[model samples]
Target chain A: MTATTDQTATAATSAKLSPYKRFTPTRGNFELWSWVFMRASGILLLVLVFGHLFVNLMLGEGIHAIDFAFVAGKWSSPFWQVWDMLMLWLGMLHGFNGVRTIINDYTEREGTRWVLKTLLVVATVFTIVLGTLVIFTFDPCIDPNSTLSVCTK
Target chain B: MTATATQPSSDEQKAGAVPTFTVTLKVQRYNPEVDEAPHFETYEVTAHATDRVLDALHQIKWEQDGSLTFRRSCAHGVCGSDAMRINGKNRLACKTLIKDVNPDKPITVEPIKGLPLEKDLVVDMEPFFDAYREIQPFLITNGHEPTRERIQSQADRDRFDDTTKCILCAACTTSCPVFWNDGQYFGPAAIVNAHRFIFDSRDDGGSQRLEILNDKEGVWRCRTTFNCTDACPRGIQVTKAIQEVKRALLTSRF
Candidate 1:
């Protein structure tokens, strides 16, 4: 018997849906892992972000204590350098993934999504790379006539 | 008709007379045969405070305009039909009273969004049903049927009791802004129905159903706006169900 109704059958109506193939673990679970990462990284980020903010903005001498020498001193140590690096990486990635999801949610056109996501990636890479470089390659003896301890040594 | 002309005052109500008032229903009208775009048409009907929005629709259809079209089967909220947007909220017309939704201004009545509109207040439900069918909403067992009925404990039944109340009304699904933006995503109703079966202890196909929902257009598309939960007439915690499914996917536990 012909399966026809009074109204015209649309594309979604006419097409026969393919059988559902059960997803195996062999297939990559990018979305699932990303979901987990968002939660896990969020918790870790809370500690890193607040710690960074407290040290820079609310610590010993507060905001005014933040100067070139202060930044140089902090980055001079491996622990602080690693801390800054982790903060930069996690913050950028978390924010990037959030924007990606926003783009996916709002943008309908494939071409538009591609362009926006490309820009997002480029901006994220630039920020993360530049931030990491500044964290590790930061110099304490940039000024030639500096009298700071590291500069003197 | 003026509002005061038919309105029974409090004194009249105290004398065992039902209070009546003129209610203007601003219904969205669209006929693909005639109109290019959907537009609103207002009809004033005399209604009691206890009158349902469905009752207003009936009065408008029967008395004012014979062409006003909508769906209503049970006339009570049981059949899940007559789910429409009343005052910009997805609700069953039969379940909503005239006074419940402020009747001072014109009550706006429209079809649920995110579905293909067939006519006035009627949408093509094939796609909605397709998503439901994709989830395979029946109880699936691994082995053949036994002679006796498959036994299920009260606790096991209670695990999925909340999701079992879904009436397939499309209220939750259509209220979702994500589904409105993208029709490809399996809407909340489909996911809710899937949750009903997935958490069933008797069903052996939870993993398979979970895998189906694990698609990009599946549970991941849910932004947890809680519009689905708010729109559910049966009070099903739709967003919570989706979250439960997401957690199940992560831990591979039911």
Candidate 2:
């Protein structure tokens, strides 16, 4: 019994040391960072999400304030533009990080990981690009001959 | 110490022995076409301390009740047929040993949640299979096949081995809360399989598969609960695969 117990203790100690010597920290840190991000983003998300909700649902005329004109009027201000931008970026990053955590937990194959991550990055870029373009380059009142709607007006 | 002094009065003392115990199993029973509601049926079976839940079920079926019905294949846990809710968590009945669970208490067995019940301990597998088939699971190569097997490196083949371990057990898919709510969302198993071919160096279907998976209801629906990972019998990292697919979609240009 004493001999067997000694062997077990030695085995346990060696097993603990093996992983540190064998595996290199490459993308695992990225996953760790992502794990940390979920909590941090979750907290920020609580604030950003609730703020957007309050502004949209509770402030002033509330639901009645929203319209095509309302959107045009809001986008006209730099302050609203910055707020919307922050919301878009934070929301997308939070969502992207959440999905990234899911991918690391599930996808086992290296090629599969590469291909899927590539696709995710591509989609994120496309959406962000298109959304940013739409946000900044707005033409509420278009004149057939003028390049800028504000200049035409 | 003399041999005469060590001798036992009974022959039973000469044989190697250990304490034995009795365990009770409470299994849920229901026949959809006949029964009004599901009910629990208990069976008392004698088992060794190291026996698995599957072993107990086998004993009950063989000795106590011949009518007890459940699905099991590849009793060693490779085949995913025996996945069920063991004490509220999805686990392969074959893989889960009774000793690992509460051996002192009666074990409770039930079918997986969020699926239509076909009978006791068996759920309708068609919806799960349908979701799997919709992902276009087969390999699609845009280029003509080479006369010799389309050459791929050992590294490239390794990319899909993890996803291939899925036995269509529905453990991962059924554990998903999103899949429970939205039937159209491509569940974890299908996405894992899709990731297999999408990353294959020899396969040319990346763009096409991506197009199919890019809908509002596709990969975007996953909520990253990690339940599927915990439930997977083969230990396939499911959440990682979904994230990789999402990453792929994000990077691909329209």
Candidate 3:
């Protein structure tokens, strides 16, 4: 009985001495939605990616058809423009979330994780913004003597 | 004594004619009282091919060195007292047969990782048990206790049958790379225990356990490495249990 009592006392003392660090309940379902989004976006990306590839590389003239002129002609239409935009956004977000999960898995220290994640956010944002601008602002006829039908019209 | 030039060939050994073979057991030992750092000590023992690793350890401790230390209670796999890193993998020494591991080469033995080593092949199990207790691994139901037992359907019991086999062996937890790096993560064993209670249809405290595991150091830390599943001596699919908990968390939140 005395040994049992001593053991209980020791357990109580250690429990008090080393309290578990309490993390406040996160405010929202960020991780849950992040988990869901990865799956949903992945499915959508498959169709958009394959369709884009088929149109550019297989539908008409195959690999030889892919050039600046082909790209410029495709981006001229709003249908292809929206398709490309969705692809860009979904692809970037999917890849970024994957890298974030990897970072969280490997990095142990708080400061190191913070530094790596900050760099990741910056890189992701820059690429997405630049890609979106190019998809929307692309023009094959910037030159004054351009011969393209869209520029002449 | 070393084996002579006339040692039995493979066919004779397989036919049960060979009485014994010499095995070199290289054990990583650390004593807080004497050692500055852990080191390996080699011992050669004559043993039948079918003898368990625990038996070899016993021969060394009983005859070779009086101070050599390790923990074993039932000396069977049930008690889970002798979980160790045998040959660079987490396994219960009592369950691993000598022949299963290549005894011709030196079989390495060491204490499980991610815990404070107390002495030779023994670690302080307080942290592991503390995590177990933190999950409130007990039936918590609301209202007055039923005079009769809380009845559960056969299907309901089957839902959690896989997780109930966990012996609280630290093998799965210690094998995890995440647990090796961060002590706070509620390693696979704790999650497996939580799963046992969580999926029980009779338990009402699942949401509470889910909330606790929903913390940053909870189920999200699992990288789906499957090391825990491979290390489990009880054949528990540890990674599947963890994924189930992760899915439960997602469904509960939304």
Candidate 4:
């Protein structure tokens, strides 16, 4: 244990209101990992999300041209497929981690934390699985009943 | 000695009122020289609604037990020395009013968390100060000093004005559960102090501060739990400052 010292004890000291109590973790670097994730994901999300938005909203004809064809046209290429897949994974992970922090901060009771984080994980997993499948496996041409140009070609 | 405690300062003395109620202070006492663990010692002090918890401790230390040890220099809320867990909440005893808390129950006072309890309410502040020093809590100026003064805009100064009010009392840091769990994490006070200079347009050292806080146990370790914000004696937007530092780190790379 480091030694304690006093500096100018005659001077005035500050006072403040009480903060809420929390249980401190005795081990692990989970907090460090979470912190790094926020920054890394934040930076990546800026690029990935802004790129996604620009392509969808600002590129040729803007929102008016967007349809099943617009989405299929982009996803058919390997480059856009990788971009959208990265966006989905990073966005979902980043958002869920952020919410997990909120859950830990506000939820006092174990039951609240347990149930909410559990639901968050379930929702996150389901979305990620469903979203990834739709991104990679989605082929308009495979749906034989479709009459769209991209589907036929 | 069943001493009648002295009345509060004239400014604090309520007019046309009688101070009659008794406040029982359950103080934690420990002496590493003799005692194995700290124990609670209760003292009933004569007080009023306007009286702060610090007044009761003074009464006990003065007339009841001079052996009772706690650190308090400024009886007011400036020094940040009297921070303790008063009634299970971290507060500056000088600023905490007895009436604000339930006076009916015995108010429990313990040393602040995340530091070694040396004796009564005193804790080892070395680690706290170490983290403060590690952050390089000072202005770094690479430019030549002007003959008169380094000119700065009022807008530039105001950008970091909130963090400039920190008293470094460790109330915000000690209150952080993160610091309590892992002392390595730069607690709110250190980050708040770093923010004071990092956002200052006049300061040329923010890049270094940004780099230092980007460590594994640095700003990233902050969980945005708001414990430091709530516990800040100066009412600084501590969590917000930490966030600002985080943004600076992320944007500095670009």
User: Which candidate number would show the highest TM-score if scored against the true structure?
Assistant: 1
Query: Which numbered prediction scores highest in DockQ against the true structure?
Result: 1
Scoring only the second chain, what is candidate 1's TM-score?
0.93
Q: After superposition, how far is residue A69 of candidate 3 from its true place, in Å?
A: 1.9
lDDT of 1 by residue, A1-153 (tens): 244443445434444441222233323367777777789889999999899999999989999999888988888789999998998999899999999999888886778999999999999999999998888777788889988897787
| Model no. 4, DockQ | 0.09
- Provide backbone clash counts, one per model: 0, 38, 0, 9
Clashes of 4: 9
Q: Candidate 1 lDDT, tens digit per residue, B1-254?
A: 34444554654345445658788889999997899999999889999878999999999999889998899999999999999999999999999999999999999999999887889999878778888999999989987888998899999999999999999999999998877875777889999999999999999999999998887778888899999999999999999999999989988832
| DockQ, prediction 3 | 0.21
Q: After superposition, how far is residue B180 of candidate 1 from its true place, in Å?
A: 0.8
lDDT measured at residue B190 in model 1 versus the true structure, 0 to 100: 95
Clashing pairs in 3: none
Weakest ten-residue segment in model 2 chain B by summed lDDT: B11-20
Off by over 4 Å in 1: A1-28, B1-15
| DockQ of all models, two decimals each | 0.29, 0.02, 0.21, 0.09
lDDT of 3 by residue, B50-152 (tens): 7999999999999898788999998889989999999999999999999999998999999999887779999878778877888999999999989998999
Error (Å) of candidate 4 at residue A104 is: 14
Determine which window of 10 residues in candidate 3 chain B has minimal summed lDDT. B1-10
